[model samples]
Target: MDGPPPLPLREQKMNSEEKSFLLPKGPSRLPVSGLRLKRPASDENEPPKVDRKRARGPLDPTKRGGPVTAAPCFPKPPPAAPGLRSHRQAAGSRRTVAAAAPKPAAAPAAAGGGEKKRAPWDLKGQVSDLRAKVGIYKEKAQGLAGENEALRQRLNQLEGELKQATARNQQLEGQNSALALELQTCQAQATESLQRVEQLVEQEQQLQETIKSQSQTIRELESAGRKAREAKEDLAAQLEAREAELRLAQESLAQRAQENEALAARKAQLEQKLHESEMERRSLHNAVQELKGNIRVFCRVRPLLSSEKEAQKPGMSHLRFPPDDSKSLVLSKAEESHVGRERKEDIVYEFNFDQVFPPSSSQEEVFEEISLLVQSALDGYHVCIFAYGQTGSGKTYTMEGPDCQDPSTAGMIPRAVQQIFRKAREMEAKGWKYHFTANFLEIYNESLRDLLVLRPERGSELEIRRVSQCTEELHVPNLCYVPVASEHEVLKLLQRAKANRSVAKTNLNERSSRSHSLFQLRIEGHNANRELHTSSVLSLVDLAGSERLDKSLSTGDRLKETQAINSSLSNLGLVITALSNKEAHVPYRNSKLTYLLQNSLGGNSKMLMFVNISPSEENFAESLNSLRFARKVNECVIGTASNRK
Candidate 1:
């Protein structure tokens, strides 16, 4: 039989494309012998059908003028049969038939002129159509070949995976059985766990109740604590108030006590002044009021010396002070006292003064009495204070004192200078400026010498000149008047002058001052508020101790010093006597001491005398003499003291 007729070019192209599309995209790894044609679903048990449509587009050499291209053939694969061996047999038979179809294509080329001769265009179209089909089939084959290689690898991998899945399924089946048993056990345990959870929830509710109760109790405690703290704060405030009141009361009491003490002291001072006024009117001459300006006399008794204490006779007291009057003192001998034995009074020698200080009185007590006069000097009143006594009678001690270490016993000179400097500072608020000059001099052997200056020799002469008659004040020429600002500087100057003083050891004293030392402080002040200037002089004199020639037992220089001392003291007595007698011509020129003190004694100056005496039986006669002299001084009337403002 002849082969089926060749298909038209368009129909052949459509059939070729259909065959390509229907064929599996991937090729089988097996040879074409293992391939099978697909069977119709309606014919399940029958062999696969021969697909002539796929075989229709064979290469026809007689139909093309040019070189002929062979048509690509694609066999449809059948469904997989139950047995791969029987299916592979059937595929091998079909492969043989397909291989024979291309033989007929070669027969047409050999037919020569007997084949239908196609036109050049028709041949070219058929050839071109065959070429296009060949190209499409080639592209599909290449793609399928690549896909086949990938599919082969995927198939191998899938086979291994399937084996693993099978084993896994078996394992899972076993695991599921075990899991079902575990689930049953877990359900039993979950029931027990739920019961425990229920118990824990109940315990939690009880714990929350306990926390609530504890919180309520804590709140109550906190409220009570707050109240207690407030009460404590109130008590503390009250305690502070009470303590403040007590402190104020204590301060008030102390202030009142101080006021009482001040009042009592003032009363005593007034009483003393009243008594002095009475005495001044009674004994100071008929010109009592006028004589008030005279030098005030105060007598101080020195304590008994050690030697006198040893020599004192038993049952004898030489010094006597009147019980009722502190201004009068009496000296009596033991032999003359007949109060108990003879019923006759003793030869009592009574002397009176402005003030009499006992030996027991302190330096401060003596200073308090003279402090007012020193203040007057700062007030522009010229003041003179002199200490007079026999040897070892404490005249120097009263004026310069024993020591400056103790302020209570520092003596009048230091205390007076200190007061001036202090008052000057205090008065600065009142616009007062003060200038103070200190001049220390001594009258030795009736000659004046600068005690503050350093001398090459003990007997060096010093310059002394009288001021002009027009000037009432006496000025010592070339006197070393040192400027002193503070009490310390004044003390230093006083110490230096004292070291330079003429002193000698005698039978009477260990260190007896042989010359009369005069320490003068002149003050000048300007008051800016009042537009006034003031000038004042404060003279502190330590007279040489008076002594008898026989008692002193002096020969050469000592004798001369004793006579000079006696002469000056006598001149001083005469000046007082003349003033007491109110004479027109007072013998101030009788001695250098008298002449130098003329203004201070009888002129416009405030003068004070301190008669120092020994409270010893052996010196009873000298003590009596000193008291008598002090009596004369007390009675003298100089002139009214004036302020140089």
Candidate 2:
């Protein structure tokens, strides 16, 4: 029932312009035709054909009028004239509807309001209005046609732009899909990077711990290095101090060395003077002994044995020693006189000697008196000491010591050997060197035998012979001359000789040396500093005891042994007596004992004799004979002793 509202002014103006463009400005050029009026179709049975053009007045809906009937109010034209008539009819009908339909409704309302209405059948005026209306409608149709054209063009342009937008939107959608995928990939990479970052953080922590420990170790090493440097400096300072002290010590040592050299030189000079003085003193001492007499005799009275003591022997009271004199002894015995009266008389025989040892004297005291004479042998003098007495009188004990010799009771032979060896060592300081050789021999039954030989050849007799024609020195041809180095060696030799010496049991004594035993030590000395050499012999003799055949009750071999011993002893006494009288010719070769002692009894030799006496009345005669012979020997002055240098 309502029409669309009018367009805006800009649209209306456009429409007007379109109308002006579309419609001719001038009047129509065609010949004017008369309006042909036709009857309205009264066919109710057939519907009227509507003029669709007039019903749809403009192509634009906004300009269209109300619905119009297809009722032919205009003329039906011939077929040949279809176009013109149709156009006219369409226009006329549209106008009628436009003008008539509203008028009727208005007419009713007007009538009610008492208003005048135009009658429906005013033909002429209606025609004129319709004509004018037709013209207006035609113009509007033309405008609408133009508007439709313009609208179509605009729609085409918009469709083209929409297609472009659609294509662009599709392209943008594809780009968005790629970006989404890239975003997914980026998210995955970021997640992986986050995980890697976590691992790196853990490694960084471990590295930090390592760095911390290394730093601690470095600090410790630095501390140690600093201490080492300080210690090195201390050591350097100590070394410097030590070097200084060493230098000072070296200087002091040099000074001390020089002083020691000078002292050594002074000591050498003093030692030389001392040696010279010692040599001179030895010369003087020997000279004093020479003046004392070369031949000296000592008397020793043996103590009564245990057997004699138990028996209370009468001879024990017969022997006597002077109270105030150590050099004199007396023998007092009661004797029956047959010529004058039948009464017992006390006969006193007194004797004097160089020295007399009483029964109380020790072997040490006896050796002390003979030690000086023994030393004279080392001083290049020939020295002889012998012990002579009857059987059981201690002659062998005094000369060679007891069978079981003790150091305290060692005889003259062992003591003399020890003294010679000791003095030889002491003389080494004075540049004297001595070599010693020893021989032990015995005169058995007028034959010379080597006591040192354990087993002698049957016919190998020892003979006393001169060493050479140029000198009077004597030696036994077959005697064993043992080179001895020490006193111990000589003592061993003495023991061996003692074991081999001749011994026998006789009526006068159980153990009596049946042969004369002689031990001789030959000393050869050299003084290299003084360019001097000397040779000497020391002869120690233990003579066989002289026993009376009647007293001993000896027969056979014992009687011969006794006779030989007595004869040699008697010759020994004769030689001493001749030397005491200063006879021109001394009978030194009468017996083996005398012949072997030739050099020792001469002027160039020193001699000592020991008369060992038994303090027993049974041996009174033999003891007196020994004492008298020793006294004769003591009184003899052979000569001043000389050294064989």
Candidate 3:
């Protein structure tokens, strides 16, 4: 062992301790290890005398110094590293020897060994042991590095998974946003649809009400239309019925025309036979020439009444007569006065027939003496039947006959119609169509008025007046005569004329005509083939009764009427007397009475007179005057006679 050839660990341990003793601890270790270590102590905490860097690193656990910096766990004298001596080998030889000198001989050899000889062996063993420990630390550091790498990989994978989860959350949020929008839109649409539905429901209800009203109205209209159609059908049926009646009338007209033709043919044949007979009968010509016209005259013979019966009979008979609706009348003193005076009279027969003839007369008799005169008129002759007598002589009766206002007597007017109709039927065709127009007029104070158109309330206003034919100022104004077909119609006219007459009672006669009444029938007849176009004028004159002013105690309107009557009667007598003598100055225009009698008194007219007289001696002078006037009228030779066979 020759002084233990310098042990490597012991040598270093010795050198290091000596150097650390020589120098201070500093940045040398850190600079060598390439670490920028933290400063061990702050500047203010270190002792002023001490080197701060050296003191801080040597004692601090945070900053190791010298050999400790490189190997912190290396024992200063690491006890006995593994199986080797601890301090003896690692420590310097100088330190080892010095330290052994102080130790006991026996203990020092067993633990530390001899300083120079044992150091080599101890150094070898400690070096080996430190190498083994360093190898163990390297293994631990490798394990830690592996664990760090594994943790880093795990962190990267977890971060990647978290990013994907974040992206998924964002996508889910987007989907939720879209779904919410769609839901909102759908909800809005549904709301709108619901509102629309509500509106539709309301409209439907309104339509239903309207339809109900319309249906009801339509029903009513249909009913009305049906009714109208039914009415139209009824009207059509009525029209058809009227049309049928018209057709029937046409057929009847045709049949009547045929019958008329047959009658006309028969009449023509009869006329031919008569003409032939006339040719064969030349010997009868002288007889016919001598007879020119057949003058057949009829006269009436009335029974005489005593003076007592005559004066009282008018009152009793008038009282017995029926009341009349046509006229409001009363019996005047003149109506009660007969031709006979109170005790005695001159005229013999009572002749008023107004109370005897009104309604109907026999067709055969027609009248007592007037049928012949009517027949003459029909034969194209002018015939005038004049009534000339005392005041109560029934002059109206003999001319036109009386109305139904007198209940006892049927009038000559009715009889006249019956006779005319009978003769018309017999004559058939002499071209004898008679258009008869009747005019009833009256003359009062030489003035003329229509009698049938009198005011009903005023008897005085109903006075008659005479009218001139060719006068500029007309008096019988606005008088129209209607065609009368039957006897009944003429009778009605007579009644109406009488009802409207004005009568003023005088002592001379009861119911004296205050005015002259004239019923003129202007007949238009065509009969030239049978020698008869005779437009004849038939005048039925009812004169105002003639009376002696001495007998009639006339007063007021009655006196004026009496004067007019006297004047007219005087004029009438003068005209008749003049015509009897064939005088040129006939004085026909002197008064209305004479003017009206122009044709009847003188012209081509045949006249008849009716005389009613009293048997009593008191009326003798008046009766004689009337008779003499009548006789003068009869003697008038106005013209040659025109009569019919």
Give the per-residue lDDT digits (tens) of candidate 2, residues 158-266: 3453454345445445655665575566556556655655665567667785766655655665565566556556655755654554454344345335534644554
lDDT of 1 by residue, 561-629 (tens): 999999999999998889878899999988888887776776577788999988777777877888888
Q: Which stretches of candidate 1 lie over 4 Å from their true place?
A: 1-293, 314-316, 334-345, 457-460
Name the candidate that leads on lDDT: 2
TM-score of each candidate structure, all chains considered together: 0.53, 0.59, 0.44
Model 1: lDDT of residue 54? 18
> Per-residue CA lDDT of candidate 3, range 175-275, in tens?
55665575566556556655655665567666785766655655665565566556556655755654554454344345335534644554454354333
List clash counts for every candidate, in order.
2, 3, 32
For model 2, what is the C-alpha lDDT against the true structure? 0.69
Query: Which residue runs does candidate 3 get wrong by more than 4 Å?
Result: 1-269, 274-307, 310-366, 397-408, 429-431, 456-477, 528-532, 641-645
Q: Model 3, residue 450: what's the lDDT? A: 68
